[model samples]
Target chain A: MEQHLVDCDLCFDALQVLQQQQYREKYQPLSASMQQYIRNSIKQVSHAHKAERYQRQEQKKESFLIYFWVVAAIAAGAGLIYLIQQQDKFKPSVTKAMASNAEIPAQRVEAPAVQAAVVTPVRAERADTLSHRPAPPAATTTAPVAPPAATPAPATPKPVIKDSVKAKTPAAVPVNKDSAKKQAPPATKPAEVKETVKAPAPEHKDTPTVAKKTEDKPEPKPVPKEKKDDDDDKPKPKPATETAASGTDEFLYKAAMVYHQQGDLNEAISRYKHLSGSSGKYGELSRYQLAVCYRSKGQTGKARRMFKEVVRMNGSMKDKAQAALDNL
Target chain B: MLQQLSNLSDKELISRARKLKDQEAEGVLMERYSHLMVAVCLPYLNNGPATSPEEIYPALLQRLSDSLKTQTIPKANEWIHYTIRAQQARTDKNSPFFPSTESREQQQIEARIEKAATNQKEQQQLIATIERTLDKLSAEEKYLLKEFYMNNKSFAALAETKQISIEKLRQTLQQAKQKMASLLMNETYE
Candidate 1:
């Protein structure tokens, strides 16, 4: 129909003009009642539009409030996550301190000694032996003699511990021992230190609270004896050398991590190598991490070698190897 | 007729024709709408009708007036018809003029119109074409068309209410006049 009308624009325009002219001749044929009925409908439609507009405006306001609440909920969730993460970071440190404080309840003889054990490695060995003895020492003496033997690295143990303790001298040993012997229950001393650290039991009213300085200056004895025993077995080897040669990745990895945490990169790197060269899950991780340790210690050459070896070995840890190589 | 349609509401247009003798709005509405309305009607109008317009036009206009009386003319876009026989029945069934027969024929016509625009694209195109051509006017012109064709207002009354001279009102309506001309002409190109 449109195609037929396209013959000429002028012809179409003329036809339109004629149609309009014809239309004007006779347009209105409506009576009065029809006009009134239509007027009422128009009023109804106008009123409906106004009501609809108000409803839509209310919906818009409700949606805006919903949007605001959703954003607030998200912000609250994020803040909660941050708070939890911050608490997690500090939680371990606080627990460690609290653990020391709550150590004594029934007979706290074990706790001060355990705390001293952590602070002074020299006294730790003595505390361990004394903790196992039939009775607690009446005075705190000869505490240093115990740590070297218990640790098996007797010579190195004393000097390092003494250096740490020099800043805070343990009380005179015999005087401390005299107070402790009077205070401690002779029967319960053997049961005090368990293989797994015991929970501090509830306080007993019968127990004496003696604040005799327990971490005594260690007695110097037979340091040369333990070193000589290690030397006699392998004349030139140190106790660390022996442990390193054991190739137990779990133990070595742990020792390396401890050293790493203590900021001893050279020692950590050496221990990490001992573990990395062995086979295990820890061994694979240790090899990758050892390279990182070497890099941290500024031994790039050694780091590159370790990283290359890790990539050459096929395992689930290959991705880790690749990442280390990329770092190199 | 188009000017009257522009002034009158659909209800008034139908109502005015209802009381008339020969039912004049049918020819005037069709003549004014001959180009566009025939296109709308063509799909609903049967080719079989030679003398059918006699029964058909009056019946269709009367039905349209009946639909207006019942406020159903707005949906005439959906209720297009081929023969006035169904409309005659529709009018008779609810007629102040004459009682009608039950219309199976109107249902059939409605079904056929539905079938003609089966493909979604075709249906969409039909609706789109109608909307675009009708929407060529500004909001005011569209409102005027709604008043005149659908509401049945008079030109003299509209001119008086708008507080304008008839000549000024005609001039103001020229934009819509030109658009309707182009729509009738089918020349939107330039």
Candidate 2:
């Protein structure tokens, strides 16, 4: 049989076919349950991919909302800082107007009759002071009024000198008439009258006598005493006039600022307009404030006009006025 | 629709599965390849009357599913073949029948027979001829073929059971194969 297989191709082929038949019988069909398991697994994998895609989209939407809120918070914080800086810019102008009002009583003494005569001259001087040396005049006036109690002490002797002046010139009598009315009861006391009559009467007659007494006094004491006398005798009437004018200007500016701060642009605009017309130290500042009020009120044309006038003046407010004009 | 899909080949079914996410296409692929996969896995199974298809089928499906995910249709078929070959090698290593020279010779013969048969009708005819020849053999010849070839028993152990020398057992197997070959030739002529 071995020799036949070696010699014949048909015998070899038949043996090979029989072996393949034995091997092919090993393959068996799968049961129904196994196929069902495979289908279920594929469905699970597909569902997982879809769920992951949905989660990714949700995360994207959430991140967008987070970024939007963060940006909105930053904008709100910036707006608050800008409002605070704007208020800070308005503060110094209000303070400057207040300081100028405080300096008024020392510079000018007001007698009602003299006030009508003195106000125009004081305004001219104040304008000149603002243009060249805004600080020095206020400093000079404040230095003299440093001791108000000392001023009254020095004023006691002035009526005596004025009484002698009345005796020398009948023209001086009407000027002392109000002083006499206030002093008549004191004048009836003989020792007080004698002391006053003795000290100042000779000084009035002889200029040398008054000069010797002023020189013999310690220098510092006499300087302020003379200043106090001058302030009491003549400048007293002018201070009242100065206070009335400066007080009104300060009040108007302060009220405008208050109204502006409170967002009442109309009332602030009216008060700032009145100050802008006045020839006072606050005129330039008030014009700038008026422009701000007009701008706030959305009256852009009026704001532009006021800012233009302030820019042309070459005043301390010119830079701010120019900035305002540029904004418009 | 399912009948049309079933008519398609494994490569065509895989393409439909990828393009349409068609469950039917995937089902058809599973059905078509399931028998081949089970045959590949059979040598790995423990020798018993009751072999668990449950354990083997899911593992086979899982490997095929993983291959489907990363591969295009053309490459997926190659991947399935490679995976089955690799699994067969691993199972072959631990098989009690490994190193059986007779089993190796039988496998070679089986490959040649399958190549020559070509179609189901010829293969079925060969199977019938083998069954007829196996029935005509002596009881001892049938027992030797069943134990050594089908059951993958070591020849030395088979020889020991038969109370024969190893040389005599080889002579008996050679004579049984020549008898089967002669019977097949006679049937072909008839």
lDDT of 2 at A28: 30
Best by DockQ: 2
Put down candidate 1 lDDT per residue, A82-127, tens digits, no spaces.
9999787556434432432342231245434544554244345434
DockQ of each: 0.02, 0.06
Q: Each model's TM-score?
A: 0.24, 0.26
TM-score of 2: 0.26
Which 10 consecutive residues of model 1 chain A have the lowest summed lDDT? A202-211
For model 2, the DockQ equals: 0.06
Every candidate's fraction of true contacts kept comes to: 0.00, 0.13
- Over B34-104, each residue of candidate 1 has an lDDT whose tens digit, in order, gives 33322222223344643243344445544554554444332222233222335523434543322111122
- Scored by CA lDDT, what does every candidate get? 0.46, 0.57
